[model samples]
Target: MTDLKRVDIYDTTLRDGAQSEDVQFSVEDKLRICRKLDALGVDYIEGGWPGANPKDDAFFARARKELNLSHSRLSAFGSTRRAAARVEEDVVVRGLLSAEVGVITIFGKSWDLHVTQALGISLAQNLELIHDTIRYLKKRVDRVFYDAEHFFDGFAANPDYARQTLEAARDAGADALILCDTNGGSLPSQVGAAVAGLRDLNAVLGIHTHNDSELAVANALAAVEAGCAHVQGTLNGLGERCGNANLISVLPNLILKMGRETSVGEERLPKLSALSRFVNELANRPTQKNQPFVGSSAFAHKGGIHVSAVLKDSRTYEHIRPEQVGNKQRVLVSDQSGRSNLLYKFSELGIELDPKDPRIQTLLEEVKSLELHGYQFDGAEGSLELRARRALGQVPTYFERRGFRVIDERRIREDEDDDRFMGAEGTVKILIGGVMEHIVAEGAGPVDALHNALTLVLSRHYPSLGEIELADYKVRILMGSGSMSGGADAIVRVLIEWNDGERRWGTVGVSDHIIAASYDAMVEALEYKLFLDKVRPV
Candidate 1:
């Protein structure tokens, strides 16, 4: 703890993260993410490489007017002066200045491989670029950071030259010298030792790591322990190649696990999960359910022994309190669940069932039977609750499905083209209040049509369904046992996520027919929504 200092959280999700495949952020997206990072209390936000593209340039132009940043300084990122260009004549340098940002960050080659092979420049000239780039930007910008790219590799190749490159930046009046594991190949020990070698310099030190080795968080923390005060990362580790260090994971590890102080206040750690999910939603990426601190399953306990122990003392199988990071303890029910797990599941469903209740054992056996048919209850608590209530003979049927029909048509246009187009329609009949209600709808597919028709019929009785929205739909095909001789009759598992503004829940269904599976999951999703509205008050 002696090396502990006030840790600065620097987010590069806008710059480096934009390089990730499928991560395409608009100008508005960048501004929104910057605002979120500010609320999270980060000290710096890399807005992007200002001159690299029209989009980044437009972002900076808008950010100058729109970004009233409170906790973080907006930074424009770019490389050092080119091998042949003067610092005064560099296009990127001009872009950085025109960005009107609070900070300027430029990366220069630290590894000899990059200096000699990549840039094809003499070692002396490369050192000059690092120094001149920082010295020139330091005048216009409030703070200038020198990212020593491939620093560990350089230090490993030639320690003296590596130290000289960093010394050149420090001497040229750089505000901070950030050591970057740019290739992300360095181990934590190597990063620590290399960063420790430069700790005595009279400049703020920082570390930026990528997750190619699956050790970006480790390396970043390792650097922190070695006296570096600033760490650069992205939310949910979004970046090129593998990804950057995940601040969502790193901040919790530092503040909660290692007792280190960071700008992300302990009181604000609860927002971590929301922040992570929001970023994922904006990036058009599904949230990783198993991500360390902020994912849905981060604190989910599924094992029987684990649940029993957690019921006694949550610390038994848990590392830290789930609520500490805006997450919750999930007691997942499945064929593997024990009595303690069953009790926890009942509690979640607002049902009271004794652990010794004979119905509990019978329900457990039923879950096992259902799982044998490819039903996985771990993520489908809504469906699990429906099954549990039916086993106890307490299920109050809200609607009885009398009949359903689906029609799919594919047509080949005559004069237009050879493209094939499809249309689907569904008809549903349900008995509610002892009266038959029939509805019809059309959609892009059979499942969508079925869902539309059911909603048309159900919302009349349960108008709260208007608040429900389909957040996600996942389908996994069950192989082996259930599949036909050539995998024709494979059972499909459908997991549907529904959010009702206030909360989100998942429902699961399994059937040999994909449409049937989807319909079952959709039914349970709506039922769970109503159950919550009736039992859990706003």
Candidate 2:
């Protein structure tokens, strides 16, 4: 850090991140994410564009009343008032001033093409909008950041005009001028050249990039390395098209990789993993398990040699300690896994096994055989534990499912002849504690019916079943092989995700029938719960 400069971290998850396809956030969601971002030690939060939409407007209103962000400054973002409109007369500019936030951010077109074509304005007039808008807002707000939209592309096309646009912002008393790769098509070298070209500008410089080219993070770092003072991004890189740069990866890359300082301290770095998951949870999107720093598999080791090396010296396989980011190292067993992988996995689960034991080899071979068929132990730890118990000659079959049936029906409604509805019913009979119990349930579909009936029967013995929920369900047709025709008997793979409010695990099932596949997955899901509570925990 001695040679590195401190960079400001500005977050736009509530604003830019929401631009992603299928992403919608309510006022409460915005406020909650703002609080979390503040807690994560971000320097500036682009809360939203105040006048652009209803949700942004409501968020600013609520935040002005309820948000007391300790570390991050809440910023209201919008365009540079509008083309040719008076700063005082423009409704968008007026709305931004009324937001009662300390900082305001407005993006202005830097590309001559956009200025002349997109806005239908002369290039000369666009500079006035960039300058006058910032100058007007700077008078009312504590700080104003000018986003030089498409700065790199503009610079590449016309470097002189691009520099002139930023010069106008610098002369307008703008606190920071952010260079945006709006199209997400710029390379890291282009970003470096662009940032370097603006080195003489008086305003503090910032970098905002999109991931369309898969180089947003790299380009941001390149700009920072070239002397940009700030970085703008969204959590998990959520945004339009590909997405903006991921702040979760950017912070660490700045602090740990580039040796630069950021508002996010080493102490709060551990919260990065949780922060990533939190934003995805709020967005109702599944976290990418393979995402670089914070994903579930970020620190996971499955190969035997890798697991063995990690056990002896974690640095051999892991670049950074998982605990440094609040993520734990995981050892998973798979068909490709060696004995060392199983040993470490078993040890973690409190199962002692000798590496040289013949049963160890047998267990490994059995796992490989099962994986060849359809079982995936890596995602289903509970199911793996059950197999381990069986190999150890321990049996705790609390209930025996005698049989189950699922019937799906489609019929035309009498009241609405044009409308048709598909309904499913399921009946399950099980021998629990030596008593036969029968249960029936109806659902919107076959899988739902099976889940409903099975959970109902299990709830009688395991009250915790009420707390368990299906977080996600995925079906992948094996080899483009699953047939859609009735009685086609095509093999399909089903992956069911279950969570008990605290922990989550994945279970897999493969069968010719979709309901039967779902049933297999569901039973394994419940059996995992029973094994954890009744066997290992005990």
Candidate 2 segments exceeding 4 Å error: 1-4, 334-538
Candidate 1, superposed: residue stretches over 4 Å from native:
1-4, 334-538
- Candidate no. 2 TM-score: 0.65
Each model's total of backbone clashes: 0, 0
Cα TM-score of candidate 1: 0.65
Please provide, for model 1 over 1-538, each residue's C-alpha lDDT reduced to its tens digit, 9 standing for 90 to 100: 2334688888999999989997887776687788778978888999999889999999999888767888888999999988778889998898888898879999999898889999999999999999898899998878998999999888999999988999999999987789999889999888888778787776788899999999999999999988888899999999999999999999998898778788787877876876786677567666788999878788888888998898788899889987778777778883233465456547756889877789888887787678677777654667888888778765567777788889997765556575587868999898888889989998778988888888888888888886777666667776664343455577777877667766656688888778888888988888777766663221
Residue 37's lDDT in candidate 1: 88
Candidate closest to the true structure, highest lDDT = 1
How big is the positional error of residue 371 in model 2, measured in Å on the Cα after superposition?
21
